[model samples]
Target: MHTRKEFLRNALVAGCAIPFISGKDFLAGARIDDFSFTSPFIRVGLRRTYPAFSFFATDSLGQGRLHLSPILTEPPRSKAFTARTYRDSISYFNSPEDIVADWQVKCEEKKIDLISRKPGAEPFEISFSRPQNHATVLGIMREGQRVLLPCILHLPGLGTFIIESRVPDATIFYDVTARESTGETPFVKLRFDGAGAKGTVKYSMRSVTLFPRKKKIHRIPLFDGYRRNFINIFQLNPRLGMLANSSSGDARASTLFLYAEVARVTPPLTKTFTAMDLIRDSLETYISGKQGYGHPGWSGNHESLDSRPSLIIAASYYIKSTSNREWAQKNYPAIKKWGEEMMRKDSTGNGLIEYGYSGNSGSWDSKIGPANWWHTIGFGHEDAYSNILCYRACSMMSDEKIFPQDEHTRACKAFAEKTKQHFFTNFYNPETGVLAGWKSGDGKLHDYYFTFVNSMAIHCGLVDKVKGKEILTKLLEKMKEVGFVDFKSGLPGNLIPIHPSDSGSKEGFQIYQNGGVSGCFAYYFIYALILCELYKPARELLLGMMDSYAKNEFEGKCPNTGMTRVWKTWNGECRGHEGFLADSYHALLVVEGVDPKIPFLNELVHFLNALTVS
Candidate 1:
């Protein structure tokens, strides 16, 4: 282990690889099967014949630990493999790089350059070096349609690393994925695949650290549990800092709302990737007229109605977190244009955003259409979920730090006020003291007591505090009334059963999107409760959910059912098909201190007060 000064001084000497970081070395009982380097910052174990068997990290206090397995993969992704046949000695990097030459992976600023050779009469050459610490930089170089490049990086509470590179005339067949391990431990697989490509590719990793708070958070079983088996659902890129719909490849543009609002993510590795990169890419995508960053923009390529607003919020958070006015000023024109496009969705001039579909019962077409993120719930026409986001987008767009004091900003302010004023009348259910999920095109209210819809409205300040409290009270009552005590699994999407005719899929009640339990919206409910000063209920909700996270119940497929755990039945059946849903962790965001503009943030104070029992 090297110190901060040594890291900056001689991180690399000759061809030997070594890691120098902020703190001292702390290795007590770590089992090492191969040549390994260990320190408070990062640890790596490498074998002469194959890729690194272990890659891990720890915070300065040595409290938080991150363990990863860096494996090599080729096409078909049939399995992860390493170079078993190699001519080499167990020569370590002077510090910790260039393990045995002949084969090598270089972590550069712009790209991860990779080169491997077969040696015998031919000497097999390889290069493996750890990049900066706390970050995982990954990339895919594709000039055009010829390149089907794929790369993604993320850690539990830490964020993603970014890499953007270009190589002309080189067919690099490689991608990177952080596959969650099947066993109970946090032994995740980070694969950089270069299978049968003719040319060169990229593979590299570095470490960065976000030191946790000095004072321990108030004792809450959930936070400690979640910290143990943390699973990352946020899949980020230049285009969109999205959430994974499943294990890999599929991206959900709208689901990132929580990542932006709750996590308020900053860049983990600032040298090559920053949170602002997502904002820039979003502008580029909007300029190119892409409806949404996710190709599964199931609804007319626009993703869902929430996409634009979600992106807007994400960008706003970046600006808020960074206080980067210059970036905002430079991009305001495109930003303003997006605002205008979003407003145009209010074709009726009723001050509420509208959708293209009729949203009549059963109007949801799973393969191609839905008005919002909950694809199978038959939400359309006038949607509460969409409006809640639209309200937030307009409210944030009017910020002086974002848009200049122009007519566009004035319009945003006015629209936000109008939305706030009309929201209750349009969506609140007088009988239930809660809001409905949506208003159908035929002028009908579809009220299933959707937990997300009401919670979102309340937390976004669409309703007054008094009304918010009333709604939360009613929601809690309904949840208990329905015998929905399975908080360990997560709160149900709706307390009442989704109508058969309204479900997009044939899946019955208590299944995916049909009253299924998930953290997707549970966080909002708990936060709203805390905001309304209902502390006990909020604490209870949080503790219950923490039980699930500690057990790693949210992600990874179940051995028996073989179904994913992010979404489950009230009775604990695995109904979700996606192996993992990152948005499920959004429920834990209240402790992250959500957003500054919202009054609830002050109530949260910090992680310490987030779960204080009253």
Candidate 2:
């Protein structure tokens, strides 16, 4: 199982190593094991051996707590006799950074410098007795790609440390050693670094001196809260000729959304390029086929062909975020193709697009179905959400003149009309004001209400604002009736009450029956409500959702539901491998709404403050 924590660490440290593929190549020999720490050296041809770590089982709180077996790589048989080894000792951290080291780091304005002093082989006590204290060396690791170390420092009571380093697309390295553990005299070593590329190393004085240890091991939660949120933000650098992640399969449209988010705010970051520029470059990668459409991000994973909508939304956000006219012109063709081929109607009189493969229709799931699964038996159709998303995409395309003026406007309007006339007519029940999943030929509604449907509708702006509001109100009421809307506790996964419709069964909270209150629903629920302007209810629901996850009953992480594993109903236990997106997504909403000028900043502020306090 490729868990989020493990994947996150892999992305943080060595995302550059993985080969980017489109959605189709999901079944290729791309093993998740390639990301494991077992292979110490990620041989990118002549690339140097970079230090790396893996994430595994952790203790209680979420910290990097894995006993990574010493990483090793295959050696040529010719040099087998003189085998080289690689290993890393245990790591630890504290708030103010007090370990065992006679090192000092100073930070004023944006400049950061570090000075280290170590006696040659002699103990600190012996060296102190000498008139001229022993050997001392100082080095500097500056903002550019430079490292100056092994030097000395003659300074004052500088109780603070600052980190001044910048890299366009490079990794950083820092290591420290200390001797002298026993002390009520806080032997502090101030160190600072940003969330993106700041990698550092420190050893306790006791560990260095081989002194008696009080605790066998300890791992402090150094980076916590929302500061952790931006870890991925400032580091969204896609490698040339390669996709960054599954999401970056098409770097172009993807950057629209990514940069849109980044361009909205200012923070303590070093990178100079705006999010818009990155988005533009990403689009170029997609258009040039450097990102290879079909395996990971393009049309590879699942046959849904719905990534066009994601691409569309990303583009819309990018345009809205930066108002970049030139970028909109350069990458309009790919965006147009995504809008047309992915969602365009068939000229053969069929109700769907040509090669409208309803392969697996999920963003995260890796399952790939047939090129065309005859929807003879299912109630809900595959491309319903796709249609809505395409409509929005076309609307944005037209707004940006990505397509010819008349063509884009006509395309957008036609798709909107067809989506409503053909799809919504059957699935939506205006009487109940709910967009059911799909309508059965037997005239019965199947999957009458689904969070996926609701989320997509709200996200794509397909759901009518007023009707959607009423439906959401009823959904919340229904959720409360089923004991799934307890604000003091956690919210349910779906508001339809996944449990038995009977009142007696409704007493239990977080239980699945009608899709139950899931931690994963936390952000989706807030997103829907916020988009619909249901502030009070959205706020209440979000708090309850967070409280539930804090308990960890759902998953070791948060925002998951107990659906597929249990009786498709009843059990409330669930965990998500990719729910971190929920936090970021939710943060975007909470922060953006409080201040529309800045998307999801309140949440970002909260996350940063929590991290600082931690």
Candidate 3:
């Protein structure tokens, strides 16, 4: 049990290492033994040896709240250890497991623990175990933390390994060597001098392997100079890859976007086989009429209109990124079927898909009805965002020569062109000086000057250069007028607030998709600004966003959410059903100019030129 003062201090210092408590118990009457501090990545359980002190730690996967254990390996032999506390010293007798000798530990509040196996001899000890100091040195190494160790083990066959057992800032000098052995177990004699003291330690080791040491050679020039600042961003792709692969075949917009973003950056890091498996499974779901619609929460739903297009886009991206022609060729028929299903949405032959009164079909999941992605507002019928994605998907599939260049490919190309033209003509709202979010069957524009819709149009090249510049400039001006220039809170989803009356769900203004700033949506806006050559504003917003991430300000605004990852909303409100919408981190790479098509396109051009020369 931690004292109230100690608990508060640990809470402040631990950051994500605090265990997430959901019930009313909340840390009151909580025991250290009640929680299992296991690293999800390594699947290793961490236990505190003394159980009196707490050390905050995170696993390789960044899942924090792990306890530090003094015992490194699960030694083969176990011996009972007794702990007794005295006025000046706390001591432990016997060995917890088969080391070379049993440990007699003397713990004090102000000084390092004096550990000795032989009585009346130089006491081997560990520093930085003082209760008042909270510097972490014993637990598993997390990113951005200095490495410190209490012991170093040298096995007969294995190399020497540092064992973290205590938090110490002082330098340690070790003169230790492993004894040559032909037996199953090996022993090592250890002596060290540190902090103006000399000591001897010993260890017996079983078979163990050390963590591999390798120098990471970057083959891509994407992060040549800005490596250190972008380390977290680089790590984010693999984390997103895990989430994308763990979708259990649901394949919703959130999961698809996560997969697409990871695929865009580095294909091998992504779980390509798992994603392809899920995509194939999702195709069956779509065919079975179980997933074309949308559902609530993280579970598979098909009610949303963008779901089908999102799957196609994700698959196309996977193919383009991985150059997995076999997967594409094998699934070509299914892919065409999915594309045909998307085309069925555009019943009017106008190239733009119309949302029936069924609901909003975009990505924004609101408490209201079936709106598109911007769920709160009335973005139904023909949505600018979904249509742009549809056009992009169509174009990607048509350009993909992995499949035969037949009538299906020709139709896809033709449809993509039609979608582009129709979207530009219909979605743009000159009255609002930006693209309309959606246009209904009545042909009236739901023109709220949406930031995402307009920016995405620019990003996907749906809007021409002149129109894109004008619209983006107007958006910036409006955002400035609405006081989004400071961006202290977050980038607004829309320049103008969504009126309750105009919203299908009657959602109030200035909350969520109605007007709330979304970090996920803001990425496209920033990318669009870069495309439009609005460098100053783009650079300012990009730096501001990075600063927010660095200072953890995004989660600060919405403290109740307990969001440690890139959130869906800029203010950290979990809007996308899932809490960590990993795609938001994709914004960081966009400033580096990550275009998934460029490499593939370059290869295609080279191949074509070679064929022509031949």
- Top candidate by TM-score: 1
User: Can you write out model 2's per-residue Cα lDDT over 1-614, one digit (the tens) per residue?
Assistant: 75533433332233112233222432122233222221111111110121112221111122221221111122222311111122312111111253422333222221222222322211111011001111111123334422222211111100111122332332233221122254221111222222222333221110001101112111112111222222122222222322222111222232244334443452322223333444444555556765433334343333343445556666666666666767767776777776776555444332334223322222112232222111111212344444555556656666634344667557765665665555556567766666765432234544435555665576556666676788788777666665553443334334553223212222343344344433332444566776677766765554433333222223222223422221112333442222112122223223332334433334433533443444
What tens-digit string does per-residue lDDT give for candidate 1 at 45-74? 445334443333432223333343222211
Error of 3 at 602 (Å): 22
Better of 1 and 2 by TM-score: 1
Models ranked on lDDT: 1, 3, 2
Q: Considering every candidate listed, which one attains the maximal lDDT?
A: 1
Alpha-carbon deviation at 296 in model 2, angstroms: 8.8
**lDDT at residue 215 of model 3 (Cα atoms):** 22
Model 3, span 1-614: residue lDDT tens? 75533432332233223343332332233334322222221112212243122222222222322233222232222433445444433344444443422243332211223344433333233222111111111111122322223322322111122343332432233221112244322211122322122333432211112221112212111111112122122111111122231111123442464445433543221111222333343434444554322444432233456766776777776676657787777777777887887888888898987665533323334354444555556667787777887887788778845456789878888999899777877977767688887777667777777877888888888887688889999988887676555542346677676665566554445555567654556677777776666765764565455444433333212345533323333344444333223334455455334354434223323432343344
Candidate ranking under TM-score, highest first, comes to 1, 3, 2
Residue 325 in model 2: shift from native, Å? Answer: 3.0
* Candidate 1 whole-model C-alpha lDDT, 0 to 1: 0.57
